[model samples]
Target: MAMSSTCAQLCLRCRGFLGSKTSTRLHYIQSHHWRIWTANSKSLSNGLFTNGSFTSTQTRQRLKQHMCYYNNLTVKYLTTEAKENKNADDTVRSTDGANLPQMPNTTALSIPENMNSLDLDAFNEPSALEEISDEEAVTIPFPTIPPSSTSLRDYVGKSETLTNLVQLGVDLWKLEQRPNVGSMLLRLDFSTDVAPRLLFLKNIGVEDSRLGYIISHNPFILTEELENLQTRVNYLVSKKFSTETVASMVSKAPYLLNFDVKRLDNRLGFYQHQLKLSASNTRNIIARLPRLLCGSLEPVKENLKVYEIELGFKLNEIQHMVIAVPKMLTAKKQKLTRIFDFLHNTMKVPHHLITKFPQVFNTNLLRLKERHLFLEYLGKAQYDPTLPNFISLDRLVSLPDETFCTEMALATLEDLYLFQKTL
Candidate 1:
């Protein structure tokens, strides 16, 4: 009897309920004085049901809803496909895969199987797609092609492409009103705002004799071609900068290029641009040099005085050569004679005599100045962080007289400013 009751309890626990069967079992026990209830028993057994049977009924109802949903979905898909097929047949369109549009045959591109979504023919002629107004096109963002495997050059050549190539060759090789290089530069400048990729090609590799060579060799030119012009120019300009002391003066500075004297020589690393100078510019430079000092045609004592002041702390071999200008400037203008006398006279002056007294005649004063000046000017010393620390010797030599003077003044100002910065 206890065993039967235990079985009934187990069944009720498994079913997650004890309401009806449990109550019947309790009534049978209280009124009829029976503790156990068998499954086959007449009274309480009829009210009981198994948990598994109830679970199966719930599962069947959920399955019915799912089946109904699947049928609806299948019917809808079939209806859409049938309508599309009917419309296609009415138009008499060929359903063969070969009839579908193909990707433009870019020279040689091996597309991967995973990129099946990409329409190769669409990339075949970029210009055709470009002609479609932006409003008509649907732009979908796609993943970038890996640099190692993808080649964009295949897509670039077209009928008009040859015309552009010929024009570029002519621009580089043929002469213009100014000169071939000048014409190329001017033509490139005009297209600067409209087509910057072309400008970047011209700007860099200025030293390369042929445009075609430059285009093929420079990775930057390739990248710039893919991007817009403004972005290309900004990047190219930044790349052209140098590590020298005068780097800042020439980089991103206004009117600075105009001041460069070596603009025409194309020798110094800096002389790619033309320094436009007038005849008047030449005259101004000759006038600015301290005139042949005195009636004797030699640099006067006054000229030496100014040299002493210019040297600031001390004089070196160059500065001492400058000091002997008086004796070197004799009546004749032979280059060797002038250089010789200048060196000879300064070496004759004794160092001890110059330092004993603060006066210019003190021989040691001049020699001591030479020693100090050599160390100070050995490298173009930077005085300010904002300006160039060094001036270019080659550039200074090539510059027109007036421009050279301007450069000197600028250098002097830079040196003074840097000195002040330290304080």
Candidate 2:
């Protein structure tokens, strides 16, 4: 009875101490104290200890173990609670009204049942990518001029000429299907001064489609003074170009009319005198390559230097080469050097033969190698120009595959086919 009273007093004291802690700690203390008391009672009832008194050291060891376990659990619980509280604080702070920006509500509005049934796929169907017409396409707006600007004013005395130019522009646009012809004419700042020159161009056989091409390409031709256009024409005629040729040149290259007469004369003189080409040859060259007259003479001069210094060609030989293949003068210096080296060193062809057949240099290097190697393999690679069996470089490279195989190589088609595969 006394021991029971003492146990009750100890339990009361434990409860009193635990009451000051959290509910979880109070519950743990009550459970642990009850377990210790029951164990002590069982030890007492079994007489496990010799003495009537409990061992204070054993009781203190058990208390220390329980305290250590409870302390670890309390520490774990406090850590979990601290983490949860921190998360809650962070969430609250992040959503604070002062820190957050106001966002618009973007909830979708409900669609009607009928609208839901519509085929939305029809809107995404592939459509033809038709070109936009000039009327539909956007263009830079024309510059606005004052109402009293000359472009807006009608020539009071030359109403007929104004009507003629407008009619001409409209008809020409219709024929060529050119857009913004009216706008372009306004931008050219057309006036009565350009009327007689247009008439003169028409009188000189530049009419209809030809005239349209000229005016469309060079609208300023209409603004050119009459004397300038006439002098250009007269200069061409003085060079013995027929009236037809002069008209054709002008229609093809209207800017030819804009070139200074002295500059044109200098270019022509270079072709005839420096290149040693006859007047007829010079005309033919100009007709064949109209751009030659348009470009500067520097390229021609540079090409001559390449021929003399690089290829070791005499002046007469260079003239012959240019006359035969005028484009060779325009060929890159590196390309010319490669071809010359291959011909002189690799093929062992004489320099005279190379100059005689300058077109050989223009032939593709791979094709040249294939043909020469195949012929060499057949022991028919004739290098001498005097030999009866000699193959001219032109005839060798220019011939069709079958003709070259049968006539030059004298091999069957199958043999040539197999040889080509090897190459």
Count of steric clashes across candidates, in order: 19, 0
Q: Write the per-residue lDDT of candidate 1 for residues 322-402, one digit (tens) a residue.
A: 233223222233333332233234333233322222222212233333322332454432222246653332232244434
lDDT of 1 at 224: 34
TM-score of decoy 2: 0.49
| Candidate 1, position 220, lDDT | 28
Model 1 lowest lDDT segment of ten: 266-275
What lDDT would each prediction earn against the true structure?
0.33, 0.65
Q: How accurate is candidate 1 locally (lDDT)?
A: 0.33
Q: Give the TM-score (vs. native) of candidate 1.
A: 0.20
Error of 2 at 183 (Å): 8.0
Report the Cα lDDT for residue 129, model 1. 33
Give the number of the best model, judged by lDDT: 2
| Candidate 2 whole-model C-alpha lDDT, 0 to 1 | 0.65
